[model samples]
Each structure stands twice: as C-alpha cells, then as structure tokens.
Target: MRKMKLPESFLFEAGPRAVLLLHAYTGSANDVRLLGRELQRHNYTVYAPQFRGHASERFEDILDEGSPDKWFADVVEATRFLKEKGYEEIAVMGLSMGGIMATRALEVGDYIGGGSFNSPIHHIGKTRLPETFISLYRSFNKRMGVPDARIQDSIPRIKTKRTQQLEEIAEFSKKVAEDLNQINVPYYIASSGNDELIDPANGQILKEALMPYTEVTYHEFPELTHVITVGPNRESFETTVIAFLNKLNWKEG
Candidate 1:
C-alpha cells in the first residue's frame, strides 16, 4: 500500500505526560503540525497521527479509502502507541472531525483530558441532499463509462463515496452527542463564531451535555474561522490548549 507524499506522523519525546493530537477529516498530520510543536516546547511528549486515506495529493483517493471507522482506529492505534512508549498520563486533543474521534478515543483509552476545536456534534446546512445528488450523478457517470479522472474533475466537492463517508461521520457524531456523559474527563471545547463549516452553537451543546458529569470549558473565538488550529489565531488556540492541559492536574509519571 503506497502512502501519500506528505509529512509523516510526528513524535517529540520530552516528558512522561503525553498528548495525542488528532487531525480533522480529510486532513493530515500537517494540519496539527504547529500545535504538536507548541506542545513539545512545553516539555510534553506529543504525537499527531495522520488519519487513514488522508494526505493524498488526489482527493479521489482519499474518498476511496476514507471511513469513520478507519479514523477511529487511527486514534486508538495512536493512543496504544503512546502507551507502549511509556506515556502514562495521556491527554487527547483534536480539530474538527478529529475532535469527534478524540472523544470516542476516551471510551477505550486512559486519557486524563480531551480538547475539541470546531467539531460538529450535529449536521448543518443542506446535509445529505447534495450527497444524494452527487450519488445520482455518479451512478449516471458510471453507467456512461465516464473516466474516473473526468468525473473527479467535473465534481470535485462531492462524490458518492465521500458523501457516504460523511453520512457515516454524521451518524457517529450523533452517537457521541447522545453519550456525552460518558466523557468524564475534563474536556475543552472551542469554536469560532465566524466558522462557515460547523455552527459554533455545537460547542455550547457539548458543554451543556457534559455539564452534569465533568468539567467543561468552552471558548468562542469570534474572529477565527473553521481551521482554528492554524492561521492567525493559532497562537491563542495553542495557548488555550496548553492552559487546559496544565490545569488537568495529572501527576507526572
């Protein structure tokens, strides 16, 4: 199996307290590269795993191999890798879809805290309609024997396979939302008021869901966009994450 020509998984050893950083859907480790470096600078071991089927130069390849289960498995495997490396006190943080997977990771890993940035706990906008249309178009194209590359070039944003993947993810997000109480660990949730992809209200929904079971800190970056981990407000995002980790009060092993 050939891997995408992109940055590999990053690991920086510094302390017993380790932090696992998960990237967003259709995104690779490079998306969280800055945050990983920042965590390492604070003397914490950091590992940012590249999600399966991501980092590919072609979007079609990603759509072909990507799935919600594969994303979840990637996080589980990353946590296990961290534990095997002697990281006892572990924390998880993710951006967007990564945030959804990070929460799921807590169910199977011994994590002290988790952070979510611009993650959607529910679907918004046209939702499945566009995907359905894309699926119909794809079927027609297939019946007509259109070349894959031509089909890809004609409709780059939506594909039947990718639409199905998104639907799977939406279902998973609903499950995570319903089981929010299972997240007993201290969690950090951040959203951008200006985010065009995920509605910022989902942050409040998560905070409300977890209020009865654990500590939840919600922050609204009014000026930022969907990609809060990178771009102009990245410094503030990293600072908030480090502050959250510092306040976790986990004993250094």
Candidate 2:
C-alpha cells in the first residue's frame, strides 16, 4: 500500500475561543498538531497553517520563498482566516520559528494575546537553525535516493543561502526587541533548558524586555528539549497554557 501524504496544515474547531498554532523552522504544521488536538480537547479551536514554502520537498522552495517577512504575512493571514470563521476571541502561539512569527503578530496583528514555545525572540544573534535546515535538506534528498556524494556537493551552496535566510530572522528579532513597547498585552513564553538550537537565555532576554510593558508568563523546563510542546512534561506545560487561556478575557459580548 502506498503511504498517504499528510496535510501541510490542520484545524481543530471546538469552541468560540480559538488558538492559532505555528510550527518550527524546517518543520510542517504537523509539529503543532498534537498540541492543537490537546487544546481542542479543552474546547479551544486550533488551527495550524503551513509556512509559505514549507512542506515542499524542494529546498530551493524554502530558500527562495520563505523568510520572516513572508512567513509573518502568512501568520497574519492565518489569523484572518480564523476571524472569518467567526472566532472573534483569537489567540496565537507557535513552536520555534512559529513562535517568532506569533510574537510579530502579537505586535501588530489581531490577537487577544499569545506566546511561543521555545521560540527565539530576543537572542537571534547566532542560531543553530541554519545547520538544522541544511541537515534536513541533505537527509530529505538522501531519502529520495539522491547519492550521498551528490548531496554533499550541494551542501555548501545550501548552507550559504540558509545562513542568509537566518539573518532575516535575526533582523526581525531585533526589530521586535526594539519595539517591545508596542506589545502591551499578555504573552506566554516557555524555554527548554536543555535546548540546543537556541540559547535558553533567550527566555530571560524576552521576559526582561517584555515584562516592563506586558503581562508575561514565563517558564523554563529543565529537562525538555527545544520542542517543549511534546516533551515528557507536556502535561504540565499544557496545564500552564490552560491557566493562561483561562485568565484571558478574550470573549465577545
């Protein structure tokens, strides 16, 4: 039997209050599907949209079509899509790069409030993401039967482009940091102490930056890796999310 291809985006509608979930760098909407289902079970509608150029087998698609600007536009569009569905009480969150996108949206988009799970907000100076993207590219091509030698031959060019793309994220993070005063709303942030891709210190960097102007709920999970949504202590993390959502007055009259 042929394997069925999973969708790039997913939605779970359960209630009037909605949450938009974002995926990680080089990952599809699937990254947040599990957490979205959990949120849905708790009666919050969940929608996870695939970033532009993501879920594509071609690495060039991501390099050429994906960037902070384009993905942030995608984030805004996803929230609009939710609003059109009649969910007026909307919140947005994301994993990693998805979290960065969520932060940008919270700055200027329509949201009651939102946060990120292991997102690189203030600390984008140097990231492991470029290498992660390149590794994924190589491994994906290898899975498609590309020769290892050929895959290696393409690594240098991919790395250069991927590094340049990462610079876009760093630039965006800098912008968010500079304009932190614009985000005068509730926001959630979580960090994995064991995270390897981004410095865990980013949680502190973000809180210190946002706390002066916003009501920030911050957590650092010592044992969890970069993806805290599906970590071992996910139950507790989910509970924290529930608590945050419950505190929000995100309802229409």
Candidate 3:
C-alpha cells in the first residue's frame, strides 16, 4: 500500500537480463544487497523492492496491506518496469516470507524467464510456533538494538485475523507451484533442513509441488538453520546460485 523509496545507490548492472530480489519480513532492500551484487556480477540488472505492509510500521499493519494479492500486483508492476527498460529476460528470487510472496507473484506475472527461492514459506499453516521461537526473536531484536520504525511491533506471529487469508495464500501458492512447472524455465531452490521458523516438512511440500517443473534444482543445507543459509553457508550458497544462473544460460543479457 506504500512505497519505500529504492536507494539510487542500488546500481542496476548494465545488462539485458534482470533479477528482482525480495526480502523477508522486517527486512529492507539492504538485506538483499549481497544477493543482488552476486547477480549483478553475472551482468544482471537487479531490482529488489521493499514489500508492502511491514512489521516496522506495526506487526498488525502488514496484515492489512501485505496480502498475497497485493504483493503479486507489486511484483508484476516491478517486472513491467524492468521490461520497459530493455531487460527482456527476467528472474525473481525471495527468501523466507518473501519467498511466499514470490510464488504468488510468479503465478500471475509475465516475462519471468526463471527464478530462485531460498527458504521459501510455501505454507503458513496453523501456528505451531514454539515459545523458544518467540524468545529468540525478541532477544535478537533487542540485541540488534537498531531502530526501525516499520518493524517495531511485538514478537512476530501469524496475525489471528489473517488466518483465512493465509489459508487462501497457501492455496494460491500451491497453484503457483503447479503453474511454475508448466513454464519452460529453469529454477533453483534452496532450503534449510533445520529452519526453526518454518517446518522442514514445508520444504518437502515445495519440492513435491515443484517436481513437475522438470528443469528444477534443489539443494538442502542440513546444518543451516532458518536464515543461516545466508549466514554460515553464505559462500556455498552463492556458489550454488551462480551455478544455477550459469545453467539457465542467464548471463549478462
């Protein structure tokens, strides 16, 4: 519902191929910068936008505006913007909650040549979060000690009123996965075997759902927990990602 001004400093590479990097909840464009840099090294124009209805504004605020439908619209608009700029071949990638949004976007958006998703939230089922999760999140937030107005809410959880919407979102995502298979494009997906935030079973669901997409590559880092794929295993993950892009023949457009 609102736009976070993209930093002019985020230089999109001089390439015909474009990649949109989406970040997770409470995350900003900066969070995806490393991934963008890597993609840019391959001559890809990168556009990583801030999603709508963020926890910074208020945890509950995201509930009102960050619906899957709105996010899908946002991604389409972003893709079209890139297309107008002469970047024809496009790919979209997202992590954590953003991954969930990407699927919905891919289902309805156009001009997507391929994509990658790391730690995607394919399903937001009944809240099964443990108390430890809440504690750890709060502790980390406190320790980080950074002031982010948009994400100043209490410990995050699935907003109660949004349960119906989440269920619908899951269904929409499932359909998106099916549609992804029909498209003749290469996809790279990475998941952590020990993602405490999302059930590992969800990873299985994603793998199974995307199985029909014949040109798919999946990697699971068993030792990587939740967001650790971008942390401890950063280099390895980046290597896999570069390989995936190379395989797709998505070099600098």
Off by over 4 Å in 3: 1-11, 55-57, 116-159, 162-165, 177-180, 251-253
Candidates' TM-scores?
Answer: 0.85, 0.94, 0.74
lDDT of 1 by residue, 69-103 (tens): 88898888888898888787899989988999998
Q: Once superposed on the true structure, which residue ranges of model 1 sit more than 4 Å away at CA? A: 1-5, 124-158
Candidate with better lDDT, 1 vs 2? 2
- Per-residue lDDT over 1-253 for candidate 2, one digit per residue giving the tens place of the 0 to 100 score: 1233644798899888999999988888888878888889988899999999888767567888888999998988898898899888788888988888888888887688899888877774456776677778987776667788988988888888888988888898788778778886799998888898888888888888898898999987888888777676788778888889878877644
Q: Candidate 3: minimum summed lDDT over ten consecutive residues — where?
A: 1-10
Please report, in order, the local distance difference test score of every candidate based on alpha carbons. Answer: 0.79, 0.84, 0.62
Comparison by TM-score, 2 against 3, better one: 2
**lDDT of residue 98 for candidate 2:** 89
Error of 2 at 93 (Å): 0.8
Residues 1-253, model 3: lDDT tens digits: 3433433325467567777777765455666688778778877678877667653524344556677777667677777777787777777777766676665555555544444444444553433334443443454444455354423454344344455555666676666765755555565677776676666666666767667754667787777766643575577777877677666655442
Model 2 ranges with Cα > 4 A deviation: 1-7, 124-126
Sort order, lDDT high to low: 2, 1, 3
